[model samples]
Target: MRGKKGNKEVLKRILLCIRPYTSLVVLSLGLAVITVGLTLYVPILTGNAVDYIAGKGSVDFGMLGKLIVLIIAAITVTAAAQWLMNHVNNMITYRIVQDLRVQAFHHLHRVPAAYVDSHPAGDLISRIITDVEQFSDGLLMGFTQLFTGVLTIAGTIVFMLTIHPLITLVVVVLSPLSFGIAGFISKNTFQMFKKQSETRGELTSLTDEMLGNLKVVEAFGYQEKAQERFEEINERLAGYSLRATFFSSLTNPATRIMYSIIYAGVTLAGCFTVIAGGLTVGRLTSFLSYTNQYTKPFNEITGVITEFQNSLASAARVFRFLDEEPETEDSPDAEELTEIQGKVELEDVAFSYRPDQRFMEHLNLSAQPGQRIAIVGPTGCGKTTLINLLMRFYDVTDGNIYVDGHEIRDITRKSLRSNFGMVLQETWLKNTTIRENIAYGKPDAADEEIIRAAKEAHAHNFIMKLPQQYDTVLGEDGGSLSQGQKQLLCIARVMLDLPPMLILDEATSSIDTMTEIRIQNAFGKMMNGRTSFIVAHRLSTIREADVILVMKDGKIIEKGTHKELLKQNGFYAELYQSQFAPS
Candidate 1:
């Protein structure tokens, strides 16, 4: 049932996963062996009873009583062994699952930002939860039963042969056919399971996409369209599931039929041998019992194999995700920036989401320490790209960016990012209290400090009005809060961090004019003596900027103060007049 790749290597990898619990594995195996031995003794005892009864002798009550005690002992021992095996198997599975979950989560953290951005959240979650769970099932039941079944089958056959070799020979002859059928079914079942896993991933991805964009679907009146897409994925998943189940279900019945035919044939042959004066009734009875014993393990082995194949399919998906390259990190020799004055420069920076379409090229800009630089541009004019580059969300395809006179790539990413605080266009808040959200950027901030930051961002009044005040729990993504409230909370989070450089990317876009004025005043105070970059489409917001850069096609076409840019009558002047001038 194992793949073409060496079973030794595959087993080695599996063993490595369980190496820490070697003692438990050994104990479970010992229990299984004991249980098998006890089970095998039952039929032999039954044969002995038949021989005693056939003899024209006394009842031999003492011997019968002893056999009875042995039977009870065997049952008790087998039950205890089964319990131990089950316990050990469960413990190992739980530990392996825990380890796997941790590894999956850690791998997710290590994966490249670009990879994560492209991967669907629901599919990834399915791999971690569903796929990993499937693997655990195989590890527990599949692995344990496989090992125990092999030993039981082998031991049962060896003892049966020792007692009656001819009967054992006949039974062994029929076994290959049974194995052939099971093997054929198992191979096909594994293929179906792989397809099933892929379909499930697609289904999860589609559902996640729809749920995440629920607002867009309703606003665009595309509810029926979304439902249709979801239904299509669901139907495909159902089809794959049915195919997998069909193949898997066939294995058991097929094995059972093959074993039943072999049993009938063996019984007829044993009866003929007895009639020919070659075997006694006791021997015939015991041989038939041993034949049945062998089939039980064979049946179990087939079931385990099917389960194992299914788990392998899930394991492949999970392993594929783990194998993906993680985010690149700076070299160990990378320079660390302890103190940053926040002087920033972009020299001939060129970037593109795709190679054919360059967003920014030869984009040169510089900002002095404590300077307030505002970037204004029409929609889709690379305003956000500038902030993204500054944050190193992506690397420049050409030229370099410098901070505090040091090349950015040369500096450690963590240290580079630590020097700046950001408030973005779309605010993201966790499902936590307002106070906790404000304190997130600086986890060690005192309650008073958190309250002060919230007040500065104009979030404190609304927060205090809630019944639980700062302790009230927010819903998922802070759905309970208004857009302005969420943005203010984000700003408050940024303020609490108090980094040397601040980048506000449309920070006031969601708030009303009155709230915007209040937030603007607060932002100006927060920006004092800190190097600041503002990316705004609203011309009125940058009226007081120390310098303005009007970006078009990722290049700065106009650079000047508000009065100078207005006088120049260039792109900046046109945008300003269009947005703020009287209608």
Candidate 2:
């Protein structure tokens, strides 16, 4: 029952995607009907032609010529209709695929960051690309064959009934056996197909992980182990694929056997009717043709059950991704945040990634306009988590964060985030020109403005050295550039637009000491009148900050200037002195 419900849900979403292309589907259906009707009619014309040749020289040449012409005309029309039907099906199928991929990708962004962080990137990519492609193939096959198959079956049954009721009943009586075979097999095969799809996703994920981090894998000399891991999953995937294919393949031959039986029985019955002089030789020939046409649908549909099962599995994966819980919507009364005071405050904040593991609690801080606050903490000390809360990437559970006296959640997230510029230790650059990467935060920035920001971030020297200068294109997140170069570009991006507030989380960690000094000077100018939060591991770099926050175990254990913290001779002093201590 649950499996049936899942299938229904997946089908419902697929139909919903098809809603915009309803016109094309209807047109395709009409063409399919016409194609089948005309195709079925040709058999009758053939039967008539056979009657014309019943006895040598008794043949009616004139009648035979007309029947032959009608047969040729019917065949031509059917072929045209079939072509038109397939064209319409392709249009509908691909259009539906386009819409689904767009929706799933767009929704991916709206989902909480945690969801993406938890899932493997390759699995997600598989759903978007591979799985979606599989779904499209299934849909295309269904449109191309399923409709015509059903129409052929119906048309043959109707035409056959008009000729002889008793013979038709014999054919109809055995159809239930074919359907039962298909239904029973299809029901059991769905689970295998679903497993096969999932295993394929895992294989993709592993391959992606290894290839993406080829450098690391080779460096660690884990190739043999990696290959073993690959083979282990590969073997499991093979088992699933084989099972799915084996079961689905059975449906075709199984139905064919039943069809063969029906065909034989009908032939004998029609031969007997002809012997009794109740049926003409031409009619028997047409009846036999209809028998093939009738069984063809059952064979085709049962055959498609293989693709249909796989498609359903792939479709289920995609729809599940589309249905992921999006990030919570802001309050209805949320308003655009404006004006640039640069003041921020966190009051009684409490949060955690997992409910049982409280990352932070009762955390509080205040930054006055133009004050430079340095956050110093050991690893896993909520330093980045604090930054995340300030930026509203993850909201506080028990407290309110305020920007210029307005609760952060009360303001639009876009407006709130736009007010702050951030540069993190980890750099990100798309496969695009350096100028575009820099101007990402400010796409309309003039060339002169972009170059100026690049100069400030100490990326101008490297940009000028590149073959294309600012127009130099990056590859795979700026892989061609050194870590420091990428970091510089990221810094230049934030420098391009110095918002009212700033976040520098180890922004200088990748650069050399000499360049760090120069870039720090640039950052000082950028942060001069803007409230800034700097989460740093190097204690010396933040000596000039107006206030230094010392964090430990998810709490701010101490807060003061460097000179004051040293005088106290506490955790902050211990950490600060150790960095500069002798080996």
Q: How close is every model to the real structure, measured as TM-score?
A: 0.93, 0.97
Runs of candidate 2 with Cα error greater than 4 angstroms are 55-57
Our tally of clashes for model 1 stands at 0
Q: What is the per-residue lDDT of model 2 for residues 3-74, given as tens digits with 9 covering 90 to 100?
A: 999999888888888889889989999999899989999999999899889955687999999998999999
In terms of TM-score, how similar is model 1 to the real structure? 0.93
CA-lDDT, candidates in order: 0.85, 0.91
lDDT of 1 by residue, 1-583 (tens): 2355633344555677788888888888888889888888888887777776675677777777787788888888988888888888899888977887898899998786667778888889899998988888877776568767888789878988877788788889989987898888888888788878877887888888888788888999999988898898888888878887888898888889988988898899899998998877887888888888888878888888888877778877787787788767787787887778889999989998788988789999899999999998888889988887888777888999999888888888888888889999988989888888888878889998998899999899999898899999998888778888899999999988799999999999999999999999999999999999999988888889999999887789999899999999988878877877898
RMSD of 2: 1.4
